[model samples]
Target chain A: MRLELGKIFIKDVQFSDETRVENGILYINKEELLKEVSGDERLRSIDVELAKPGEEVRIIPVKDVIEPRVKVEGKGGIFPGFISKVDTVGSGRTHVLKGAAVVTTGKIVGFQEGIIDMTGEGAKYTPFSKTNNIVLVCEPVDNLPQHEHEEAVRMVGFKAACYLGRAGKNVEPDEIKVYETLPLLEQVNMYPHLPKVVYVYMLQSQGLLHDTYVYGVDAKKIIPTFIYPTEVFDGAIVSGNCVSACDKNPTYVHMNNPIIEDLYERHGKDINFIGCIITNENVYLADKERSSNYTAKLVEFLGADAAIISEEGFGNPDADLVMNCNKIEEKGIKTVLVTDEYAGRDGASQSLADSTPKGDAVVTAGNANELILLPPMKKIIGHVEAADIIAGGFAGSLREDGSIEAEIQVITGATSEVGFGYLSAKGF
Target chain B: MKLKPVILTNNPLTKSSLENKYSVLYKKEASLLDILMFARDYVHKGHRLLTHPLMGSIKPNQTPFKSVAVSKECFNDVDLLSLEIIEESILKAEQLIKSKKTPVYTDKVLEDFSLIDFDLIKNALN
Candidate 1:
């Protein structure tokens, strides 16, 4: 499949009378955007706010971050299954409102949510701090179950992103990037001399509240399967999990996956970017064994000489990561594993819960356990009081002086295993 | 049940949901470590560990509850892979638990953790 992504650069976002993009400014009619994302009875209230780069704003307990995109010409619309019909996507022109994102913030799973600081010492760790954010503070109606609340908030982010994406429909893009992944035989033949390289994509599908979707179906229900690299750019996969904020691949990262982009950049030159094999990280040992075995089979089936395996979340998924690495390596495929560390705060602890000597070529996305001091921002969105009980926080983590001392795990995309964030390691 | 007989868990939700279909050993006050250690003992006794001990994204120290699926029947020989995994998971859990900043969840938050812990193993119970 082939895709032409028209990039509409949005440098600034502000509430205006009309909702449109003009002169690189994304003007939002707050009322209209809310209406577009509202009507979910489970959500009692929805407030739209904007946080630009270098602002004194903090979005707490962020659920998911999504890039606003419109399918100018594609087999299917954006967010297939959730927002659009489940038609096969990944062929045609899609307009991306790049540099801007829709950030969903609330107490979905309470402690597992993330925080995004627009301008502060914390901003350096998260990629979202750089994006012009359209913040949705969604409050669930009383007595809403966690599952339903997660569903309601997840939809709001998708709907608002879709609504805002319409602004880039007719407007000409600042730049256009073309991404294509042809049939296996053709792609391999196109670069016959180059080494065949494939990507083993692991989705967080542990269970409810830690789920990912492919064509709107819970990924836990699907086995390891092949996917066109371009399909992901067209919104074929999305994050529905409220895993720890630091490493979860928010929908925006899926749309602009750096690994895919980098591989494509070297496509036809250094290596043959054959395809992507997506597998779920289930909570079952049998499922883990089955999925890893299937993943290895698919990698070997592609005749891939090498593979780059990336994981989402940590702990339980670390086992999945190791199993995939070992199985693929045993199949004679050189594997490069990308994951973040939960090493001790002093960086003097074992990195992964599981490991394989076969995992020789590994890329570390820094450590999630490293502590940081985030000076409180002047403006706060969502609940700030959640800091003390957050995943990376302890009792009294939120200081009375408005500053927070916690692990980078509380920061969104701080240690993104997909290599999406700024924090990573370099061998001395 | 595909692999059944024992659902070693601390979450009542998982036990209540699977008790009829499977033999559940529910421990109401069991910590994450306790549940894993019990699963290890069962593994040593020759019962197969069905699901991954570390199921949820919640770190062992972060969430107080855990539910492990183990086989009902026991053999004279223990599964080496099961033993290795349960050990590694326990080791990882221990490291995090000793990190010196464990979470102290309130009753409301504990309920959320209970559901999350249950959700992680619900599909694996099958």
Candidate 2:
């Protein structure tokens, strides 16, 4: 009988008739050990040799006893859903979820000792604070009111609004200011107003690489920022759960990825949220059908849990109506429309009512100002500790099935200050 | 060139800044030199900050010059990584330069590089 130990084998053990006393303890015979070792069938390859008494008692096995093991060889698999990676080492090696390769080098901490020593430094520098909570969100040009736009500029330290120029046209700073100054959002009467805080998006003139770049703003008076390139893995751009860019203004800056849960953790239940005004309308571009497809893809890409849209009768009525309905349905996001019901003798909403697939759509009535105040939103009634409020644009032109999408933007402002608002899309 | 080094403790001296934000033992502004001075005064009159029986202090001059040099060694690799970080950090610095051109500070345009921990690099290599 032979005994296997990992890759090693032992055999040729002496068999003692009985146990003997050695150094005040009883020592078992090698023959009994060999019998126990060969009991398993997996050890059949091992051949144990037993030695007689006075013959240097020893046990030996004939075969190597290496155990079989399994391991994944390469990066050949895909993760099914949103997974996050974090680096433990101070080096750039980051740990990916459901995978082995490090995602980044900056997040990792290198040595345990070094970490202990430097951990005090981070605390000394005031790494965390509560005064810098802020969130910035952008809206279309025509949606925001004039007064509110000026307020936005003063509050967030910049003007914000949609770009109303032709794609490819040079966007001057003055021209950008025009859209940025649209007073779009009405401050809700439920919270204390932080004079210098607002959330808005921006349309940078990237020349020809892409049309417009979008991002979530997390603080006020923060120098302009950029994200850690969100990966475009499988045709769709993957926005990481985090955002970067905090070196702008040292005094009033915040850093953290704008994932929903992170907002909850920092603010807990004491969140001050403002209402989101979505601009609702459907139009076209150089290629109407192609543009529609791109819009649909963007909706899916944003992946908001739910949204509210307003579609207006702006361009090609039939195509725009159908386009809105088709786009939102494709994204599979829950939607509610706050537009007027088209009044016909037959009680139908619009000419394309039959053509537009019916599901869950709301139709409104009255003048534009009346429509603005129509359908008082009950969701934003109580959670109004909002320091920032983001509004949307025209939404009546949508067909019965068309829907718009939006997100709840919350920022870890420059300290512990937080800005909460909603990001929405409508006019094209 | 000889390197100048400073050692800080969790303690704060009289009217230290850390006292405003955090609770601390001893003097917050107390440096290695201050600690030495306090020890000398204590030896003259039998007063001491540390009297735990098992604790002791080694003067800077009493320490072997080689040991003083040893402490400097701790920064060599860190300095190297800092250089690499500075080199790699150029792209972000350029971005900041570009962003500064705009009058308004946009959250979307700033780079949160402070979130990057450089200590991680040395720890990994070690």
Candidate 3:
């Protein structure tokens, strides 16, 4: 039987570049079609190939035709604004609260106990960890899935650390309690102070060879960090050049997925494949609902440690709720969201403001030396405005998901090793 | 159900140019699968080894952050994988294309298919 076929190309207005949108049917002629679809800038570039009346046309499929979406993008404040200092309470000892972290108007805010109460959408802090001074609002235990329970617990750990930091009035670097969910199997000795990351992924998604890229940032430094997943995918044949160059003393995790481990051993790249570690016994089914549940539970299970949910909930409604939970305050913990593409202006503004308050200053990335000639950390701890950072050889681009995506090349700068800047009200 | 499949040719010209010289939404989805399987049937009818595959896999966590270039070799052995997984996945994806598909296509039986779910897509070594 003969078939009629056509294709559609969708180009986002934000970029001048063209993108093809497939699975569209064309009922008109290609010649007449060019004039019909070619006028608007967004639609200006398109290519349509229709089969002859009798020609047999083959159809192909692409995933994510429709999925609940979350946009991850990041933009640093270029101009500095009003700056204030945080008052170090109790001479090194202050009890904190339990609450999640949030971003509002380009600031990251970490609140203390009983500061605010918010549900899914209202303007309040989200809990990144659990705290002793405050209560953590969690998915009701009855209706709670196993995953949400885990996330709640994880937040508890983060909150506990924040509380101890306040109570002890000092938390030694080694004494600080940090929970890393990323699975790291290959351990190379480099920065001893670098926190270990434990990656938790779905078992079904595990492959002998694959290419995976991860972007990260030091919460304290607020700078970007990147990682890749090759052994988990199938045969890792990554095209990009930076893939291999960045693997020096890389930190990765391999789980007990023997099938996947075997595949990586056979077909994996030349890089070192380290040993495996046992975290949660539950296997991620690789289903959406299950993945969401796993992610929520992972965050909850961390018990007051930093919970980074990258893949599963990037653009779901869960993102808003997960990113907005202020339970960290009640728990007296600190939280940060590593987003690659954020939503619109309102969501962006809210996320930024929620993550940091006005007085807080953005420190030099990957640097231990604190900034001098600047106000005290507390006096301007949270009151800072947006920050404009120019580092690495490459320029940074802000994504819709509120994450920074850039091909950054490290360069030697005069001022700070990584570069530190302020984001106060005066700059805006 | 009738399907509409698009053929992506090596002839770069055959690939849509208006967008970034490549095709999107052709990897796996309800609408795309509905169309791809129909075309695969045609390829099967010819009884020839379909060397070049017209479809590929898409990651669930995938976003428009950066454009990914898929290997053409991955397309060669798609039939080695089960089609049932792809077919079953369409049912669960009902909410995604509710506005785009015909009402008759709303059969709940489609939900029974999960193997073909987008998140299930993986790079096959065979």
Candidate 4:
């Protein structure tokens, strides 16, 4: 499979009469975009607003962030099995509204959502801060159940992104990059001298606000499977969960996974970059055992010499990571694990809840418990009271002056286990 | 045949909805630590853990409710791996609770927490 990604670099976003990308600036039609997400009976009301980088704006209780892209020339539309029909994607040309995003906001679970400040200390921690954002502030209908509320907000993000993505249909891309992976036999033969590498992509599917979806199917319902790395570019996988603000992989992260990009960079130069084997992090112990067993078997069956495994969330998923690592290593396949830490506020606690001697090559994505102070912004989107009730927050997290002091866990994607985050360290 | 699973929980939603359907050991006045310790004791008695003790990404101290499942049948010897995980979960919950005070939740927020906990473990219990 091969994919050509056309990047339309967006300079700025503004509310305009028609929703379209013009001269590198994204002009959103608020009324049209609202209508795009309207008619959901679960939503009492929905509103859209623009937030740009370097602005004194703070968006609170954010649920998900998604990039806008259009399938200009592909076998199927974007975001398969989600807002779009389920057709096998990952081939042909796609146009991306680069540097622009759709950020969904609502109080689904008080502690489940995260914060994305467009500027100030909090801005640096979230990747969304750098993108031109279309913020959706939604209110659930009176007495709507929490699960229904989560589903309502989750679909709005996808629908809004799909609506916005149409703007890039006819626009020419500033730059285009092509990615291709041949059939297993041809791929191996294409890189006979290089090491065969595979990626163990773990999806979060524990429950409710802790679930991920592939092709619109709840990941918990699926077993370990193989997928072309390029398929992810067309939204073969997406996040339907938002647990901790720091560690969860939002839809945007899945579409633009950094690990897949790094592997492609050295595809022929160093490693074979054989496709990716996807698995889930289930809450049941037996489910974990079953999934990891299949994952290791798939890696060995692919004749992989090495694999880089990335985890989503922590704690429960840590057990899955350890199992995948140990089982694959037992097959004599080298593995490199990618994950974040929760080493307490003082950084004195053990990094992960589970570990094994086989996990020798590991990369850490900072600590979720590291403390940070966010300065107050002049303008606030969504609700402000959420600061005190969020996961990393305590009773007095929201101060009288409006500033918030809590762990970095309150910031979205601050410690992304997929290497999408900016925090890391060097061992000296 | 698979042995019936025993659920140890402090979540109101779980008890109200699942009690009639499954065997539930509901703790009315238990903190996060209490339920985890209960699961640890069950594991120490040779009951294998069915669900991950630390199931949700929501930290142990942040959410007030918890629900975990353990096998009803017990062996003569304990499963050390199960004991280790439950012990670590208990310690993490204790440390976080001791370091910071749990939030004084609003009535609506409390319902939200209960719903989330039930949704996470309802499949396992069923």
The count of residue-pair clashes in candidate 2 stands at: 101
TM-score of 4: 0.98
The C-alpha TM-scores of every prediction are: 0.98, 0.19, 0.23, 0.98
Candidate 1 lDDT tens digits, B1-126: 356558898888888877887788989888889999999999999999888887777778788888888888898999988888899888888888888535777888888988888777777665
**DockQ list for all candidates:** 0.73, 0.01, 0.01, 0.71
- Alpha-carbon RMSD, candidate 2: 33.0
- Provide the overall lDDT of each model, using Cα atoms, as 2-decimal numbers: 0.89, 0.20, 0.20, 0.89
Native contacts retained by candidate 2: 0.00
In candidate 1, stretches whose alpha carbon ends up further than 4 angstroms from where it belongs are none
What's the lDDT for residue A411 in model 2? Answer: 14
Candidate 2 ranges with C-alpha deviation above 4 Å: A1-286, A314-318, A342-355, A367-428, B1-126
Candidate 2 per-residue lDDT, tens place, A164-272, comes to 0011122111111000111113322222342211111111110111011122221111222212111111001111111111101111111122222232232213432
Q: Tell me the interface RMSD of model 3, in angstroms.
A: 18.1
On residues B1-126, what C-alpha lDDT tens digit does candidate 3 reach at each position? 111222322222122331343233332323433443443443334322121121111111111111111222223444422232223223222222331222221122122112122111221111
For candidate 4, lDDT tens digit of each residue in A1-428? 99999999998999999998999999988999998899999999999988999999989898999999889987988889977789899999989999999999998766556899999898988888999999999999887877788889988998898899899999989999999999899999998999999999999999888888899999998999999998999888988787798988989999999999999999999899999999999988888989999999999999999999999987899999999999999999999999998888887777887888999988988988888999999988998988888879877889999999999999999999998989876672
**Candidate 3: tens digits of C-alpha lDDT, residues A1-428:** 01111111211111112221112211223343233323323221233322111112111100000000010111111000101012111111111111111111101111000111111110111111110111122222343332233223322322222222222122111121111112232232322233322222311122111122211111111111222232221111111000111110001111112222332343223322222111111111112223344344443443323322221111121222232233322233333322221111122212111132421322212211112111111111111211112111111222333232211111111111111111112222
Error of 2 at B96 (Å): 56
